[model samples]
Target chain A: MCELLGMSANVPTDICFSFTGLMQRGGNTGPHRDGWGITFYEGKGFRNFKDPNPSCDSKIAELVQNYPIKSCAVISHIRQANRGAVNLENTHPFTRELWGRYWTFAHNGQLCDYQDLVTGRHRPVGQTDSELSFCWLLKQMEDKYPQPPQDMASVFKFIAQCCDKLREKGVFNMLLSDGEYVMTYCTNHLYWITRRAPFGKASLIDEDVEINFQEETTPNDVVSVIATQPLTDNEEWHRMKPGEFGLFHCGELADGNADQLIDVPFAEKKVKCQAPTEPLE
Target chain B: MCELLGMSANVPTDICFSFTGLMQRGGNTGPHRDGWGITFYEGKGFRNFKDPNPSCDSKIAELVQNYPIKSCAVISHIRQANRGAVNLENTHPFTRELWGRYWTFAHNGQLCDYQDLVTGRHRPVGQTDSELSFCWLLKQMEDKYPQPPQDMASVFKFIAQCCDKLREKGVFNMLLSDGEYVMTYCTNHLYWITRRAPFGKASLIDEDVEINFQEETTPNDVVSVIATQPLTDNEEWHRMKPGEFGLFHCGELADGNADQLIDVPFAEKKVKCQAPTEPLE
Candidate 1:
């Protein structure tokens, strides 16, 4: 399976610390060595850096880790190719423009029988099942709302429904963002941690690096990071159950109807569906 | 005004040498210090690196210069920010998906009264005259052909007509590519040079660097470089006239109708129209 890493923040912040831990898993600590990509959303604008090479040996990935590009939303992926060839086109963290906003998506799990999913104006440039799924989701959203909806909760609800359908195909843990809001849907493995005031020290699980969150933030700053696996061992990450969905805005779980939105339960936790595409298996 | 650079090659060629010279003009050698961006196409897939920071001092730009990412088509820009703010959103080389291909564009001149150019499905995420023109162009193309046209020459003709209309508003030197063909339109300043066998040494105008093409390229390789100005001082560059459009494919001016497609002049060469937004004036 590929790994996904995302961040949503109240203010523009950099993901250098968390990314440093995840880069090790791209090759050194784990087996997702096909390719890796990351997208940084600076308000309505964003930039993506992708390398067909393994992250552990990528100069572009190293530049990204060193450059503290402050952004409110970020999506990153390290891929282990299954359905697509190991090429630059098959790299993860694909983005397409919708409703005058660039929507970015990265998928962690594989999907089976996804070729039947019809897409509209948004089409996949790459051959990955992940990209096909993202295009299909965007088509569904665009079909529902010709423009951005007046009520965004309906948007989140619709996304949950679409993801629930996709989960039925196979593992479909995904992280999607449209510059302002980050929506996460979990089918198998996903975890998130929100750090605010009264933050303490944290140590990376994959690397021998420690960081003090207190020194890196203001008292009012709130930042949430979602990943396939917990990057920091000391932090209390909320392990998402299968079929759980989350909508994060300004670094916190969005307040209104979040309780209802968080627990959809389309599939039971640890349910083994019929799919040989699962990379972990 | 801004500086535009593009490359089209028969083989997957790296633009490190030319980009190194262009990076110097971002802040050190010229005045386009607002921001910079570049897109490299690998088949139908592309990766974009943009920075609101000046390219001369940008670490990302440094990484790009050092990393020889090979691509057959590349579009890059350095902006001085006349019509928009100096932010990441307004950076040049804006991209949108059309006909399932990522269409990359970079404009070097300003447009006057461009808000009336209505766009359809494709919309501009960034607030810039350049992006507005790109979106408008895509909308026009989409309206003309729901699918990719069987006769690409007709598509080029339509693009030339649209560019002629855009040039009527103001200076609109642009470089656009759909990962296959590099289309160039000039109103003020644009130049191109193609190199193949019997290549010699070339010296950069902006940087103290020289490269021997004999060592870097094979005999079968045909590479073309297009820029707002001639990057290499020693090479003879073809200066495109006002209202001229050229379509390049596989590093050569596409034959069969290239002579008929090369020149479609609608404006005078030295005619200075009314664009109060001109930065170089």
Candidate 2:
């Protein structure tokens, strides 16, 4: 098992504060010390920094923690290495291009017999079960829709269906994004917190650092962070229930209530995946 | 246009010395100030570092220069951004996984009417003639052989054939690799130099730096570097002729002489692409 971290913001925001807390767990506060990786999306573009070294002493991790790379969507992971060897290729936060958009994924749980998932368009370069699962998911999406679908709700439903099937094998908490939307599926131990106008000071649980959101942002700015464990001790983080799938867009949940998975006719799930205020491409 | 740099070595070697010279061209010594990126291959594993900011002053670039991440193969680029916007998406040294191997590419020249080269299975996530050309080439390879072909020489011939076609569009100088081999195609400007046993001192042309290879390398080390121009002022670099495609493996030219390309019957090309010592996987 490993740890996962993600962020979605209304404006281009950095994860330096949260990442600082997480790095401590990579051999310091915890034992997820195999490797760590992070991806930051800037508009339709993103930059990924990964190292097979322990994050606590990695020079690249130090740079990432210092550099305030602003992004609307971000996904990160620290691996403990179960299925794959500790190597750069097996590092977490894998990325592949789909529908002319870069899709990034990070998984926090182990799976058994993942080779059963047949892949077509996308294939894994690494030996990790996490990468194979990511490729399997993308292959399913590409097979289902050769192009971007107009109805995103159906796509999410299809993804959830696949996740449900994957969970039957083992734990399957995950964080996936396409630079615009972050879809988080939790099978166990996931939490999220949204900070908006009434932002306040928060202290990190792992590190002895504190930041005042009031000084760091404007009143209109909204940011949401999701992690395997809560990074801040003072903030009221929402603990997600098992089997819950949540979609976040611009620092807010697209689904009003993320607790229920209602069974509906395939044709009735026509809710557009894009925000109502934004025009479809 | 951009500046391309690549390395193929028999042993895992650090490129900090050569990269120190190349990064200077990103802005300090040349006009390629848009962005820069590099991919280092460690066995079957690889790590990529990219930045949209000028490499000369980039913090990430600084770290890459100071840190010595050793690898057997490397591909790097510094962009001037003629066809696409100066952004992270348009950064060079694009990567894609095929045949369970990561195919990395970096182009130093521009192409006209590149959109006409249709792509299938593989597509460009970034808007650049370079990336589109890479996708088109990969699609052609996948179409020709679904799996890793036993005859790699034929694959190189096919790649050269594709390069011959792409060259008709415009300047198409490029460097491509699959972790083991480095394929260089020249149209406008490209140079290479192989340094082995009798190592000598070398001085950089762009930056005020000098290194005596005798103190840095072992007698058995054989390393080859390909670049748009001779990086060091002291070394004698061979200038590749227009329309020439060269294949390098284990720091030596796989093709005995890279000066000529003969039109051979499709079925007659049976030269294996891998090093003689390496077993086919």
**Candidate 1: tens digits of C-alpha lDDT, residues A1-281:** 89999998877788999999999998899898888999988758888988777898787888888878777889999988898987777898888888888999999888899999998888888898899999999999999999766566677778888999999999999999988788899999999999999989999998899999899888988899999999998878998888888887778766323556435332222122111121110
State each candidate's clash count. 0, 0
Residue ranges of candidate 1 with Cα displaced over 4 Å: A255-281, B255-281
What interface RMSD does each of the candidate structures achieve? 11.6, 8.6
TM-score (chain B) for model 1?
0.91
Distance from true position, residue A50, model 2, in Å?
A: 0.7
lDDT of 1 by residue, B35-54 (tens): 99999888688889888779
Instruction: Identify the runs in model 2 with alpha carbons over 4 angstroms from their true place.
Output: A256-281, B256-281
Report lDDT per candidate. Answer: 0.84, 0.84
What RMSD does each model have against the real structure?
9.5, 5.6
Model 2 is docked with a DockQ of 0.32
Query: Once model 1 is optimally superposed onto the true structure by TM-score, how far is the C-alpha of residue B79 displaced, in angstroms?
Result: 0.4
Question: How many clashes show up in model 1?
Answer: 0
